[model samples]
Target: MRGDAETTRATGSPPALRRGACPTLAAPMQTGDGLLARLRPASGFFTAAAFLDLLDAAEAFGSGRLDITARGNLQIRGLRAESVAPLSAAVARAGIVPCEGIAVEVPPLAGLDPSEWADPRPLARKLAERIADSGLDLAPKLAVIVDGGGRLHLDGVAADIKLVAGAADPRPVWHLLVAGRPTGVSGSVDAMIEAAMSVVADIAAYGSAARARDLPAEPLPPGSSSLALREAAMSPVGRFDLGASVVLGVAPAFGQMAAHIVRPLILAAVAEGVSAVRLAPGRAILLVGPAGWNTSVLVSLAASLGFVVHAGDPALRIDACAGQAGCASGRIDTHAVASHLIAHAPALMDGSLDLHVSGCAKGCARPRVADLTLVAMSCDGRPGLSIVLGGRAGDSPVATKRLEDGPSAITALGQRVAETVEKGESAAACLQRLGPARIAAAFSAARFNGIDHAGL
Candidate 1:
C-alpha cells in the first residue's frame, strides 16, 4: 500500500472493524467523537514550522483538538470522512510521513546525547529498512525499542523486542531483550539486528495473535554472549543539560491541548531558539536549544499556556479521558470531576498515587491498573461513576455512585483520604488502615446524606 493511501478510508465511511485495527493517517478509526487519525513522525522529531503547519491542517480539516499519545505520536481527532484524504495530503506536503511496518522506537535524544553508551540511530535506521523489506507479516501493534543507555531510557515503555545498551565491562555491548527480559548480548549492531530479525520472523510465523512472550524459550543466537543489565533511573520530565546546550521537557495536561494553544506554544518555542521539538515517552515535548537559553521564561510561558512544567504537578497524578465533551461513549465529565477532586484535596498528589478517571469501560486514557479508578457506568438506568479500588477500568467496581453526586462526594472522599494520610501515613498504609468496608460505607454515606466529613 502507498504511504499516502493509508491516511483515509477508500469508501469514505467508518471502518467496520475499528477496534481490531491500528488507526493510521490512511485509515482512521471511528470513535465516539468522529474519525481519529494518528501520525508518527519519520525521524521521531518535528520542526517548529512543520508542527505549526500540521496544526493548521488539523484545524482546517478536522476538530481543533490534538493529542500527544503515550508513545509520542500525534493524533488528530474529530475528522469527517471526507477530510481524511485532504488531511493526509496536507500532512505529507508538510514533510510529515507516517511510520510503516513494525514500529521501532528510540529515545528522543537518540543521536545527540554524547554520554550515551552507543548511538542507536544508525542501527535503528537499518532495522526499520530491514523490517520494511522483510515481507514478514506481523501484528499491527508489534513494536521494538532501541535504547542507547542514555539518561533518558526506554525501560519503562513496553515493547515486543528491546535492544538496550549494556555497560562497558572493557567493551560496550548491546543486550537483546524480549518482552523486557534480556535474552542475550551482542557486541555489534549487525549481530543485534540479526538476532532481533530472527525473533521477529519467528513471531510472525507463530500467527497474528502470538506475541514475543508467548513464544517458547530458546537458546541464544550463535556467537552471542550474556550480561546482567540494570535499568537506568531517569525522569523524562524536568530540564536536562546536553553538554553545551540544554533541553526542557514540557508536558501538556493529560497529554492533550487545544489546537489554539499548540500554535502559540510552537511559535513561542521557535522564537526562543528551539530548533527541533522531540516527543519523548511519558508524553513530554523536549525543546532543544543553546546552552544559555532562557528556560525559566519559556517554562513560565508554557505554564501560562496550560502546559505542565513541574513533575510534581497535581494534574500529573490524575489520568482522565476526554469525557462527555469529546467522546460520545462518556457518561460523565471526567476531567471536571478530576479537577474538582484535585483542587478540593491536594493530598492525592503527595506521592506515587495512581488515579485514573475513565469515561467508559474501554479505558482509552489508561488501561493499566491504578490505585483509584473511576469508571463511568449506568446505575438504576442513570449515568453513574463506578469506584474501583486497586484495579483497571474494566475491573468490577467495589462501589457505585450517581454522576450528579460525583463532585461533592468525591471531594468529601478525598478529604477523608487526605485526613487518613495526614496522620504521618503512606498512601498504601492509609488504604490498608481504612479497609474497603469502611471506605465503601463513607462513599455510600456521602452519596445518601450529601454530608462532607473527614472520617471514613
Candidate 2:
C-alpha cells in the first residue's frame, strides 16, 4: 500500500484529487472564470494583445483581480457560472494556444541568454502539441520542463516529468519522477508522454493515490511510447535584457494591485519600449524593457506597482493565496489579514522572514521554500493558520515545520521572527547570515501554553 493510500484510508477520505475537472475550468465552456481554465504560457511568452485581453477578462468576467501561480501561469478571478464558453473563445481568439505542452516550462530568458546549451523553446512547443492531439486523457495539471543548458532547473518544484539535457547525448534525455523522486529515464518524448498519460489514467481509473512520486520503482512498461528527441535550433540574438522577476519574492501586501494606480504605470513602461510583461509568482510583474531604460525610472515603476522599494523593506518576503474570493475551500480571507499585517506590522517583520499564508492545507500559493509559512486549518467555528519557520530554496530545498497553532499565535510569532532577523543589521545581510535553528527558536518562543521545543 502506498503512503498516500494509507493516509487517505486513515482519514476515511476519497482518493487525493487527481482527475476531476479543475475548479477554474469545470464549466461546459471550460474557461477561466469558473476557476477551471488555467492558461499555461509556453516558456512564459504572451503577446501584448493577449495580455490586454487577459486583463480585460479578469476585470470584466471575473473578480477584478489577478494571480500569478507558483507554476508560472496567469489566473483570473471573479468568474461566474456560465462564463467559460465566452472566456475560452476570447482566449483562443487572442492567439494564446492551449496545447498539451502547457506544462513545458523553459527558463525565463531562454533566447536572451548568451551561454545556454540549447534553446528549448521550439522543442517544447513540438512536444506540447503532440501530447495535446494524442487523444490520451491526461491530468490537466500534468506538467514537464526542458532545461536548455541553463544554470537553473526545477530541483524541488513538483512536476510529473522533466526532460533535462545530457552532457554528451545529442538527443535530450527524459527523467521521470513519481512525486519529486526519480523513477526512470527515457530517450523518447512521445514515450515519456505515453508513460505520463498511463500514470494519470491509472490513478484516475483505480482511484489510486499515485503521483509522479508513487510509480513503482521498476522498469517502465516498454512499447510504442517513445519518440525521437532532437535539439532546438539556436539563434544569435543581440544583447537584450529580457526582464525576469526576482525569485522567491512575495508582494508587500496580500497580492493586491490598486487598479487605477498600477495600470498607467504598466502602460507607461510599455510606451517606453518594454517588449512584454510577465505576471510573476508572488504577485509581481516583470517588465522586459529595452536595453537603456533609466535605472531610476525602473525603480519608480516598481514602486508604482505597489511595492515599497527601499533599503530594508521587510514586507517583500510575505505572500498569500487568494483565500476567500478565489477558492471555495478557503475558510478565511487570508489576503485581507495579510494586507493588514504587511502594512501595520513592519516593525514585527524583518527582511529575512519569508511568510506564506494558504487558505487551505493544499499549500497552492506558496510552493517554494520559505523562512516562515502560515497555512490555514479549521478548528471549531473559528479558522486559524499553522506557522512554520526556517525554510530555504537552492539546489536542495528545505521546507519548514509548524511552530505555532493559530492565526493570532502565528502573527505573534512572525513579529519575533522579523525582529530577530533585524538584529542590528540590514535585511539582506541578516537573511544571508541567519540560520534555520535560530529562526526556529524565535517561532518556538511564541508557542502558547505548554508546547515544548521537541522539534527544535
Candidate 3:
C-alpha cells in the first residue's frame, strides 16, 4: 500500500499503489478483492470486437467482474501482481491504447450532438497534448471537463479545471473555471487552455497529492454563467437522435456487470452495425449507429438484457460497493441490502435523493455525501448496518441495526417516510422536516402510524 515515489525508491518493484493515485495497467491498486486496474480508451470509445476481447482478457487474468466507474472509466477487478504484465499484453494485443496523462474530458456525444455550441474534442485534444508535453507531473487524479453546451454536458462533474462553451452569436464563447471557482478568463479555446495549464502548474507547485481544492482562497469575479445542472440520474440513458447520427445509451444494473453478460449487447450492436461504443458518465454505455438507423430494436434488446435503458430506472440512484462477496474489507452484503431497499422502500426512493450502501467506512463506491448512507460494519462481532442521515459513508451513524434486521428496519423506515410526506412534497423534504431524531426513531421501528405496506 506504499507505492509513493519515496517509498518506491526505498523498496523496489513499485511497492504498492500510492494513496490517491489513479490505477493504470503499469501500476495497479491493491484492494480487498486483489489488485484492481483501470483502463480508459484514448479515443473515448471501443470497437465492439476490441471491447469484447478486453473482456476476455479480464476473465482470463482476473475475476470476470468489471466496473464502469461513475466517471465512465473501465475497471478490472481481482488482479494479481503476477498477472499485471500479461493483462497489459492482452490489452495491447486487443489494440487498446489506454489514455495517459492529464484527463481532458468531453461529452460522449462531442461532435455529434446538435445541441452543442461547438465540439470540445479538438480543444480537449490540444489541451491534453500541451499538458502531456509540459512534463508537469501533476496529480494523477487531475481532470479538465470541457462542456460545449450540449444536451449531455458535464456541468455537475467535479474537476480541477472546467471549460464551458456558450452559444455562437457569431462564434461560441468559452468560459474557464479553476477548482470549481470561475476565473474572469474567458474567450477562445486557446485562452481557456492556457488559463487551465497556468492553474495546473500552480497546483503542481504544491506537490503530487495537492489538488485544486487545496489552494488558498483567492476572490475573483464570476464568469458570465453556468449551465443549469441536473441530477446524475438524469444523465442521458436512452436513445437519442443526434441529427446526423443516432445513439442508444444503456447501463448495467448498478454499473457492475459480468464481462460475459455483454455478449448479447455486443451481438446486438454488431447486428445494428454500431460504429463505436463510448463510456458515459453515470455509468452509461453509448452505442453509436449510422444516421437514421432504427435504434429502438437495440434499445429493446438492452433493456431486455437487464440494462438500465432510461433515466427513471431505480438502479441509477443507488450506489453500492462490492461487499462481502467481492472484497475482503466488506462487513456485509451491500448489494443484497440495495435489493431489499428497492423492493421494500419504493415510497422513500422517489427519485429525490441518492442512497449509498457502503461495505465499509472507505465509501469507495460513492465518495460524496448522499441523502442516506448505510455503512455495513460489525456490531459486537455481529454484522450490522449503521444509518447515517444526510451524511457520508464514514460519518458517525445516528442509528444502527443488525444486518439480519436490516430488511424489516428499512421497510419500517420507508413506511414512516411514506406517511410523513405531504402532497407534492419530495421524500427528501419530508426527511428534513421529520429531522434526524425522527428518522432515527423510524429506523428504531418507533411508529409513524405507517403508510401502506400492502404489497411489500
Candidate 4:
C-alpha cells in the first residue's frame, strides 16, 4: 500500500471516497462489515449532539469501538458496507468536517489557556478553512502549531508550520515554524496562514516530493526557496506548567465507555466551561475549557463511571493496545492483565514509572521507551508473558530490558516493582537507587515462582 494513495483520499472529493491500498482510510472505505470513517479534527471541538452522534454511529455502523489515532483523529471500524452513505451523512450531521489539506495539530488547551498571549484555535480554524476554501491547486506537506500558555507541549509530534503564542508582545505574536523550525513572525493570523500557504505553493511547484525530513536529496524538486526566520519573546511562565498529565492519561475499564457515562463526563467538564473535548492519543478524552475547577468532584465522577482515575495517582502509567478479542494480531488479553496490575498499582509504581502492554510483538500502543514493558507470547503450549523494565523517555532515553518470560503473575510482578522501589529510600531519589540488579532478580524469580498468585 502506497502512503500517497492513502493521503490522496484526504484531498479527494466529497460523497465518493477514493479507493486506496492503505488499510487505514484517509477517506471512507467500505468492507463487508462497515465503512471505516476517518475524521479530521482540526481544533478538536464538537457539539454535544455531535458527540452523541459519534456514539450512535459507533453503535449503528461499527463494532461499538472507536479507535483514536496517534494524530488525535477518530477512526470508526467494522461498519456495514451498505452504511457508507448514511454513515458519512451522520458524521457530517455530527459536525465533523472532512479535511482535504495538510493536518495541523496544536496544544489541546490552545484557546483557553490563561497564560497564552492569544487563543490559537480560532486562528487555526482560519488557516485550515482558508486552505480548503482557496481551492489551492497544490499538495503541500505543511503542518502548523499554536502553542497555548499551558505546559502540555507538542514536541514528539511533527509539524511544518508551528505558531507559538506566548511571546513578549501584549498581543500574541505568531511565529511561523517551517519544517518544525521557526521560519518567520507575523502579528496577524491571516499573515501567518498566508506565509504557510506560500510554502505549500513551493512544494507543489518545486517537487519537494518527500516529507520535510527528506530534504537532503540532491537535485531538489522544481521549486525550492529559503524562508526568513523570526524569534518569539519568552514569557515568565514555566514551560512545563501544563498542570498534571491528567488530560489524556485517564482510561476507562476495557477502554470502553457508554453514552450515559461519556455524556455525563463531558457535561461535568462543560459545566466547568471547558473550551473543547479532544480524543487523546492515549485513548482517553481531554476536557479543556477553563482551569481551577473542583478536581475532587471530577475525579469522583470519572471513578464512578468506572474509569481508572489517574488524577494525582502516579502509578497508573501503563498502557496497552487492543489485545485478544479486539485485535486480530493480539495473542493475549493484555487489557485484562493491565487492569489487574492497575488494581494493585500501589505495589507496582517505583517512584515514577510507565509501562506498555503489547499484544504480540507489534507494540502498537507505544513505540517509545517505558519504565516497564509486558510483551505477550505463547510458549511451551501455555500462554506466557515477557517482562522488561528500567526504560526511560526524552533526552538520554532507553528501552526497557526483557528480563523474564513464561506465565508470570501480574500482581506478583506489581509487588516486585513496588518492593524494589521502597528500599528505605526517599521519594526524591532516582529510580536506579533501588538497584537495577535487585529489580532484575525479583523479576527473574517472580517469572518462575517467587510470589504466590492464589486468587489470580
Instruction: For each candidate in the order shown, give its overall lDDT on alpha carbons.
Output: 0.78, 0.51, 0.81, 0.54
Candidate 2 lDDT tens digits, 1-456: 145334434553323334443333322222222443455554476655567666666566566566655544666565554454456557767777553323567655555554455566775666666656655555555656655654333443456665554443675555455555445455456665665555555544533333454445565555523323434322111123434422112232444543344456556656666656554433445555666555466566566666554534544456676666566666556665565456645644654456676666655566566655555543344454444544321112122223333333444444654665554775445544555555445444444446542211
Candidate 2 residue spans exceeding 4 A from truth: 1-36, 100-102, 149-153, 166-210, 218-262, 279-284, 307-316, 324-333, 339-354, 360-456
Residues 1-456 of candidate 1 have per-residue lDDT tens digits of: 563464235566544433455787767888888888888887888877888888899999888787777777788998998888888789888887778666789988887777778888888889989988998777788879988867787877889998888777765688888876667656678888998898899898898766898888767767666655555546566888888668888888887777899788788888888888888877778888777776888888888998889877777677787877788887777777677767875655565578888888988878778888878888778777777888889899877877766665676666777777756776666766797776666565565445432111
What root-mean-square deviation over C-alphas does model 2 reach?
A: 10.6
The number of the candidate with the highest lDDT is: 3
Residue 108 miss distance in model 4 (angstroms): 2.3
What candidate 4 gets wrong by more than 4 Å, as runs, is: 1-36, 69-71, 129-143, 151-160, 176-191, 194-209, 216-276, 280-283, 286-299, 308-310, 314-316, 343-351, 369-371, 380-382, 388-442, 447-456
Worst 10 residues of 1 by lDDT: 447-456
Q: Rank order by lDDT, top first?
A: 3, 1, 4, 2
Give candidate 2's TM-score.
0.63
Clashing residue pair totals per candidate (backbone < 3 A): 4, 20, 0, 14
TM-score, one value per model: 0.91, 0.63, 0.91, 0.67
lDDT of 2: 0.51
Tens-digit lDDT track of model 3 for 289-327: 888888777878888888888788787889988877778
* Residue-level error in angstroms, candidate 1, position 216: 2.4
| Deviation in Å, model 2, residue 29 alpha carbon | 12
CA RMSD per model (angstroms)? 3.5, 10.6, 4.2, 8.1
Model 3: colliding residue pairs: none
List clashing residue pairs in candidate 1.
Answer: 6-26, 7-25, 7-26, 8-26
Position 441, candidate 2: lDDT: 51
Error of 2 at 382 (Å): 5.0
